[model samples]
Target: MQITQKIPPFLERNLGNVLIIAFLAILYIPILLYWYDGWLNKSINIEHEYFSHALIGFPYATYLIFGKNRHQWQKLPNKNHPLGGFLLALGLAFYITGSAELVAISFPIIITGVMLWLKGMPGLRLNGFPLLLILLATPNSIPYLLTPYTLPLQKFIAAMAGFLLQQLRVNSQVDGIYLYVNNIPVEVAPYCAGLKMLFTSLYVSLLLLHWTGKISDRGRVITLLSGALIISTLANIIRNTLLAVFHGNGQHKAFEILHDGWGGDIYSTGMLIVIIGLNWSLDRFEESSMIISDEKDDNFNE
Candidate 1:
């Protein structure tokens, strides 16, 4: 005897939608209960620093995910897997442990489990980068972790600024992280050390690479990210040097303007422009090389 199993037509046809709705519902409760405060705090923290601009990546990621999945949603298979179940349990356990950082970190796992259960591996592949972008919304705290490196960075910036000031015939002396010009002390604060800018630049670089489709190539992606980081650091150093010069020269108004006003905004904007421009140029170069290679192959065949 042979046994046959069948799915009802309605259930089979609407399974994708039903699974998606169920997945969202499953994610909603835990996220709201366990992770909302962390997200709120992240939003609050970005309001007053270089990281403020990185908040844009959240909506951008949402749009990217929606755009990526909009056409494929109906094609997704509705299937449940044992791995998805395990991941879901693990994510919940992390959330229930009441560690805010862990909860924030677990979101992608939870969402991945839902996607895998709903649409299997294909869904996970399609949503991975967008899902990972959620981590960018985690509050920026790398500065605290890199506190050991801050003093050295501050000292370096102060020294460089002092050297530049001396080259310009302005008497300046570097005392640790302080640059004294005409005996006016200019402290190289941690904020001036560019940690915040570095973090923001890295986030923006990743977002750009993902959006531009360059992230598919691991080598190029690493190169682009490294370039972005270097450019950001250099830009910060330049800004800090200029600020030091202004403060050393006893230009209090100029220093304050650059530190906290339109001057600061302009400098940040310029740094971002340079970073984005470099990324665009690198992507174009890659595309051009690919085209040239294809043409060479065609010629060789002919």
Candidate 2:
């Protein structure tokens, strides 16, 4: 008699999913780790820290895919189609080229292909918010694209900070992107032009519009996005003002802590909290206006 083995029922049932997951892990894990290294330890400029915002993207995407939305993912239909096969094939071809840039480019194509192949075209098109999140989170050469604008912003920050310092009775002057605080020249380098903070805030604002269902309200979305941009700009101006005061007035240690240590993180976290508070305030204001409008309509109907 031939020897036989029994497969665990659960394992047998989920074998396809397991295989797909394993294949993805092998294909994507290296790339993901590479990105992780860049985000945390190897920014293009240690001072600018632009790529660090990508650090927020992965965790948030995971939560979107498998947290409260887990059931939605579970309900998707699994199907096999040639379009999916073509995408997968294309993504794989790109991956094997041994070019990091090409691999980065292929990342979303692979995600789309996988979604279509596993969940059908309808699922890919209709229930694809998670895909958009992943795409947004994917770090790119955006910092490079934004480089030219940094000088103008740097000038703005220096001027604004100089004004704030004068209000505080501190003698400050701005020359282009350089601020003379206590007659000590402090340059507002492009690296510390707050590009990362501004970029991250804009991104997080878009995510908020989607998460809070504010995207459906086009006017409110525009207002909120504009608010986010303004808040980021103001926050950066304040941060640089403080830094100018600290560094120009012989508080070098304090300036270093704020610029290169946990102080910076605390300030950034505070900025994000403020943005969230803005979102909450807008929501409450909108609800109150709706309530008043409904009351007016009721009186009209009477």
Candidate 3:
């Protein structure tokens, strides 16, 4: 049967969105596939396990975009904002560089511009996090950029773990980034420096702030971020100490389990719960103060 020549009413209303979606799909599909292959290959190697975060970032962003917020997509008005025009042009410029990292950066900028061109600032404010989260997903220069600065963190964690081991009556020594627990040398590699944990925890804290609609409260946001940083740092120190203890005592299976297995996952989940709990406690305190103030106002009126 011949198809009708007429465009559907829905398509008629959303032609611009359809075109933009098609263009983005063309631009990003290959980039995503490349990273997916890298993640798959890296998953088998313990040293490169950080690449696995690339696997979840996009899927989670997609969830945020189309799962909870799907209804808002149709409400945008497609008139280009001046800022959006500039951003779109800039993103297009990056797209021609033939560098995967630049191209990944371009995706978020292009998405930002598209959102602005379609619905302006309000739309961006509503849906910006998912696009921004894509920055963490792609293969980029993040590791290279972060490596030089990671030594300090590595040294610090090594020192802390050594101290913990000594406190636990384990013979330990700390020399630079090497920790000797019962003289079984454990190197605190750059990847073990806790920067990834810190970065990941900070990002998750941002997610909580955005979801809770607490992003506007700068004081609370800063407070929450600071708390996340401290919690993640301590958690990393504890994790490393335990791993060293396990390995020092010749508990190879336990060391491997905690190093990159279910033990690590459980530890991470526990850290996440602590961060969430901090947020919850802060909110409860604020609510209690407000209620107390209300009661004081009622007493003054009486």
Candidate 3, TM-score vs. the true structure? 0.83
RMSD for each of the candidates: 6.8, 2.9, 3.4
The 0-to-1 C-alpha lDDT of every candidate, in the order given, reads 0.72, 0.79, 0.80
Candidate 1, run of 10 with poorest lDDT: 39-48
lDDT of 2 by residue, 9-56 (tens): 988976876787788888889878767775665443443246466677
TM-score of 1: 0.72
Off by over 4 Å in 1: 1-43, 46-53, 81-109, 260-262, 283-302
Q: Give TM-scores for every candidate, taking all chains together and pairing residue i with residue i.
A: 0.72, 0.86, 0.83
Q: Compared with the true structure, what per-residue lDDT tens digits does model 1 show for residues 1-302? A: 99998989988977766676686668555544333443334333322344454356656766866666757855766667778888888888877787755665566678777778777788777777777776555443555566776888888878877777788787778899998877888888876788767777788888888777777779877887798788887887778777777876778899888887778767877888888998888878888999999999999999
Whole-model lDDT, candidate 1? 0.72
After the best TM-score superposition of candidate 2, give how far the Cα of residue 173 lies from its true spot, in angstroms: 1.5
Model 3 C-alpha lDDT per residue in residues 1-302, reported as the tens digit of each score:
88769989999976877898899999988876766775565443333345456565677777887777768765655455789889999999999997766886898888888888877887787777787777655455676568788888899988888888888888889999988877898888877887767766787777788778897899989999999999999999999898888888899999998887778877877998899999999999999999999999999999
Stretches > 4 Å off in candidate 3: 1-5, 33-77, 81-98, 116-126, 136-138
| Runs in model 2 lying further than 4 Å from the true structure | 1-10, 30-34, 37-49, 67-83
